[model samples]
Target: MTGHFLSFEGIDGSGKSTQARMLADHLRQAGRDVVLTREPGGSAGAEEIRRLVLEGDPDKWSAETEILLFTAARRDHLEKTVWPALEDGKVVICDRFADSTRLYQGITRGDLRGVVDRLHDQMIACEPDLTFVIDMDPAMGLARAKGRQGTEERFEDFGLGLQERMREGFLNLAHEFADRCVVVDGARAIDAVAADVARITMDRLSPDAASA
Candidate 1:
């Protein structure tokens, strides 16, 4: 059986990362071979690129330059981490993926959605088998993000305005990729959200669904 690729996406502090980790733990406890990783720093090379992108000032690089950096990091991640684990038939749960770029760069960086798409098509032409977008209000999400402390605050520091825009971008993307994207309301309790994610994931991984 081939491994399944699953990704979790949301604006910063939408609890997507927590849900992703919870799902990974759930799958592991159920005896599934799983590899939980994240971008833009899954593999070593990608980690180096991640620093370049996530550290430094928010405007350290142009939108186009940042896109290229992210694509390069993703390429390295797929080559060194995701592909190999999938080839071994291990479920790969990524915290974030290309959809993040499509939303973040596409929204904050001016009219670069077309360039983002083109770069994705040319370089990282892969999508998760399933993606869960945790939807939440930007105000609440920003509050949650602000509670955390880290030097990797470049993106998180964009504040509530950008997050609000990002929320819309994610919703639109969910509609655009409805066949493979599932939107989960994230304003509820963490356990409630995790339960929803797990149930959906298991249904998707069932024999009938997998064979389909």
Candidate 2:
């Protein structure tokens, strides 16, 4: 219960991957036992699911189906890797978690409230000690995402309107989990944003502000 489980969230356009790694690197430098991993991944089984869900160009899976895939991978990740890492007292840094399901599936899905409620209540109860939601525009996010290596996956390429709704969903999530989540401006320079993230994480991890 005293271990730190931190998660990073944002739309595809948001620079969470960069910031998450930056934060992890910063934590490592400070001598913290950090475990950096991402969701829909982080294990062999989950990686296969990630490939199918993200890389496969499929129009068959509905929103609910996608949500189910994510949670399945999530449950595997928790049981096989994340939970063990936490028990070992490592500060776990996850790129995405159940939140993505709510944003991508809930907001844009046909049954928004229902999808959100089910996942919130039934699936993910072990909320992170801290969750940083990097906020940015969908158009800009897709552009930034495109700049990353390789071609856009099915999810990354989902249009700007979908991205906007995803952003709104994360914002609402932030409001709902204000004590643990803080929306950091991701539109800024990558290094500047990284610095802010590091600062926030460091402050929270500091002995004097351990409960932060």
Candidate 3:
């Protein structure tokens, strides 16, 4: 874990994916090695699992089943993609990680947060060095997510109510993991949000960070 691991999280359509990519690009331009990946699907095996979890009907899988699938995918991702990159001291910017699971499948449908945590500790014990929780209004975020017209709309198809709950869940998660979490308002212009992310990341990467 010599390299920095970063993750972006938010309710659906919170522009976290975009910010993750922007931060990766920013780091790359500064001559740092960057590996931008996303979870539920970062490696080959994980990508296959991603389609299973992200596509199809909203009820295709139970919350319990989804947790298993996500944890398995995360395990594969770490073995095949994340660990190797980190071993090489590359910046790994992930679009989503275990946090998303802790929300989407954990608290949203039931009181499975404990289950998710236990499985995460047992199977995928990785957490980002830094996490950016993008904050956005649920309704607006849902609209943006729907606008994508992508097949990965299974979660979005869960509708506005789910998004609303997820928003609150993510905000609370930021507090729970405050040391490594930074909540960024995502309602602003893309460049503005990106700029803030870049600055924050650079500050964290600075040699003085430990002192600061």
Candidate 4:
């Protein structure tokens, strides 16, 4: 319980990945024991799942299949990477976790609430101390995504409508986990977003996360 786990959530092109790395670097500079990683791609087995998932199309991946794949990856990541570090009191910064499954696979793709919950219980059920939801409009978000033409992954290849629903998914998640989630405007500048994240990091990890 002394260790803190923070997750960065948002639609594609919302700058969450960037912010996660930046925050990790800041924490490291501050002399914190921080271990940076991402869901579905942190461990070797999980990363392979990432490839399968990203390459999966809307028609190919059923809701059940997607959730199963996510949990499989999550199990490997937790066992191989996340839990061990957290046991050592390291601050774990994951790019995305179960929320991504809830959104992309559960909410957007179709209905898999039952499946998602069951898998979470079965594997990768750790709740984060805090989750930063980088919010943004779908169109604007996709425009930013288009900028990454060369590196677009399967999930990042979602169309505008899918992106929009994902945005809603994120918003709904922030609402559902209000006490454990912080919503930031991803539309802001990188440093600006980083500053907010840094301030939050200081507030929580330091003796002040619950205070100013």
Candidate 5:
């Protein structure tokens, strides 16, 4: 049996996590088996890595070092969480995936995208079957993120400038991977955005659509 792998990507506080949960709940209500997860920590080992990367100062690790750390976590996550679910024909919804690394540690610091790509190809050569890129204004995203007052504010502490660049990067990725990436407008009400996501995902999950 095979399963679908879906990922949500966007600048921080774009509401991707909420949407991920909503989608999981929707799928479950529809009687579909679903596994919801996230990164830079999904599995046990990766969760430990998550704190190291997400709780420190903004300068805790260079972008290059971050790339390695993220890749390591991703490999562990796939082995311990994602792969097993997919093997069981369970729909796997991940809050963030390699694309986040491709941006956060790739171009945000400098032009280390090549390094990120190479490392990913070598150690974590997997991609979600479909990706939801929640598009939002950088200023709004940062403000919402700060309002959360979470300890994992290392990335948020980078300021609005980082979010702006990451926004552009995510948009560019939608074009680059148009086949599997769908950009969802995230400025609307929660129900509205969730409705759109459910409609789109249901269509993708349809038997005819899958067979096509």
Candidate 6:
């Protein structure tokens, strides 16, 4: 049996990582083999790139340079982690993926959507079988992100306005990729959001659906 690829995406503090873990745990309990990973640090090489891109001065790299670095990390992640796990029939649950690049870089850099898309098509052309975009208000999300302590404060440091733009970008992506993307209300309680994620994931991974 082939495995399913699912990714969780959202603003900085929309609880996407927690939900991704929850779904992976839930599926594992249900007897499915699950590979819970994240980008742009899923593989060894990617992790190094992650530090360069994430733990620096916000302006450490130019917009174009940042995009190139992200794409390189993604390529390493796919080659070393994601593709191998999928080929081995393990359900792959990623905390974030290429869509993060699309939204973050697309919003921060001017007129870079075309570059992002072209890079994706040429280098990283795969999408998750299902994507859960946890929707929430930028204000609330920023507040939550501010509570976190990490050197990865580069993207989180974008503040509320950028977060708002990112929210819109993600929502647009959900609509654009309606077949594989689902927007979940992330403002609710953690358990509530987890329940929704699990249910939707099971629906897609069910035997009948799988054989469809």
Candidate 3 global lDDT: 0.91
Steric clash pairs (candidate 6):
none
- Model 1: what TM-score? 0.95
lDDT (tens digit, per residue) of candidate 6 on 20-125:
9998888777777889999889999999999999886777887788889999999999999999988888889999998999888866556798898899999999
What is the lDDT of every predicted structure here? 0.89, 0.80, 0.91, 0.83, 0.91, 0.88
TM-score of each: 0.95, 0.90, 0.96, 0.92, 0.96, 0.95
Give me candidate 6's TM-score against the actual structure.
Answer: 0.95
- Expressed as tens digits, the lDDT of each residue in 95-187 for candidate 3 is 999999999999999899999999999998889999999999999999999999999999999999999999999999999999999999999
For candidate 3, the per-residue lDDT at 74 reads: 95
**Residue 151 C-alpha lDDT in model 3:** 92
Give the distance in Å from residue 82's predicted Cα in candidate 5 to where it truly belongs: 0.2
Write model 4 residue lDDT over 1-212, tens digit each, in one string: 56788999998889999999998888777677888999878999999988887764546677778788888898999889888888887889999988888887777877877778777876666888889999988888888877887443566665788988898888988999898889999898899999999888677655522222
- Which scores higher on TM-score, 1 or 5? 5
1 or 3: which has the higher TM-score?
3
The ten-residue window of minimal lDDT in model 1 covers 203-212
Which pairs clash in the backbone of model 1? none
Q: How accurate is candidate 4 locally (lDDT)?
A: 0.83
| Off by more than 4 A, model 6 | 208-212
Candidate 6 lDDT for residue 96? 95
